[model samples]
Target: MDESYYKYHLFFCVNTRSDGGPCCGDSSAPQLRDYAKQRIGELGDAIPGNVRVNTAGCMNRCAEGPVLVIYPEAVWYRYQNRADIDEIITEHLCNGRPVSRLRI
Candidate 1:
């Protein structure tokens, strides 16, 4: 297989369940997405180039809401706060190691 264009593609699920169902948005995923983006930007060359972070819709795992999935490995994770985001960025995106504790 050809090399990936991006080293890592991280998708933060930000789906909002209007029916009061569990969702990543219920845990402030949108804001966390923004935080990850801003933090990645701030890290600059500290983080490898070609790592993409984005917000996604329902991943059909709302029961495990506040989740993110990282590709090309397709590792899914559940996170709570900024610290978790930082750990994901540092351990996964920066160092090529997925944060096992956060994995769902």
Candidate 2:
């Protein structure tokens, strides 16, 4: 496995359920994931390998809906809006410091 492709891999759970089950999609996970991607792109040449932001199906943690997990460090976070995403990027991706307030 060529793990060097990206320094960090972020998986955002954007699962949607028509059965009215608790899901990340209900909390705007896709939109926030896009916001996070844009923010990472804005970093330009500041970081290491690419910080990949991807959408994922049910992570089986709907109770912690709107969740995202970061690789290498394997940190899990539950976010609500763009601000939270910004903090995650600035604190975690940029500074090598995970945002404790957002961690799940």
Candidate 3:
């Protein structure tokens, strides 16, 4: 991998349940993940391989629900919808500053 990149990676937990436990996909994991991936793709292409966005199993933070983690920076976030995901991508991933309002 190229060292010019900041080595940032974001992982979204997409756990689901029939019994109703807290999960990232519980509210809108698929939508969020899709949005995240698409937004990252849109944003990262400008930088060309600086960040990686991915799907995860549980992230062991189900209690927090709708959780996502960014590595190297190790920032954790809880989001409600596509708008939040978009903000994260625009304000944090693209700008090098974390979205403090959404951090969890």
Candidate 4:
């Protein structure tokens, strides 16, 4: 068996909007997910066997828009941009503390 370091897995809800209702697509889900992946790699913590950034179909929190859920802990977040994603990566992913300001 291979060893893994990351204790958390994050998933962004990139569900699209077709009915003109609210959804992650209407916000910054794509950007956030991309930013997260990049940041993780840049931090040298993006081991495919440990941490993974994935796109989810729907988290059922469309109203929140740009929703991301961290697993192995299952913390949901609502973000607005790169800064929020950064905070999550730094505070939550790296430091093991959830960013209460962005919790959803």
lDDT of each: 0.89, 0.89, 0.80, 0.83
- Give lDDT tens digits, candidate 3, residues 18-103: 67877676778877888888777776555434777788887888888789998877899989888898888877776778999998
Q: At residue 37, what lDDT does model 4 achieve?
A: 88
What is the C-alpha lDDT profile of model 4 across 40-78, one tens digit per residue? Answer: 889874333468888899878988878889987889999
The local lDDT score (0 to 100) that residue 103 gets in candidate 4 is 94
Q: After superposition, how far is residue 43 of candidate 3 from its true place, in Å?
A: 2.7
Residues 45-89, candidate 2: write the lDDT tens digits. 776668899899999989987899999899999999899998888
Which residue pairs show backbone clashes in model 1? none
Q: Which residue runs of candidate 4 sit more than 4 Å off their true CA positions?
A: 1-6, 45-49
Which residue pairs collide in model 3, if any? none
Q: Give the poorly placed runs of model 3, Cα more than 4 Å off.
A: 1-6, 45-49
Task: Report the Cα RMSD per candidate.
Answer: 1.4, 1.5, 2.5, 2.8
What 10-residue stretch in candidate 1 is worst by lDDT?
A: 46-55
Worst 10 residues of 2 by lDDT: 42-51
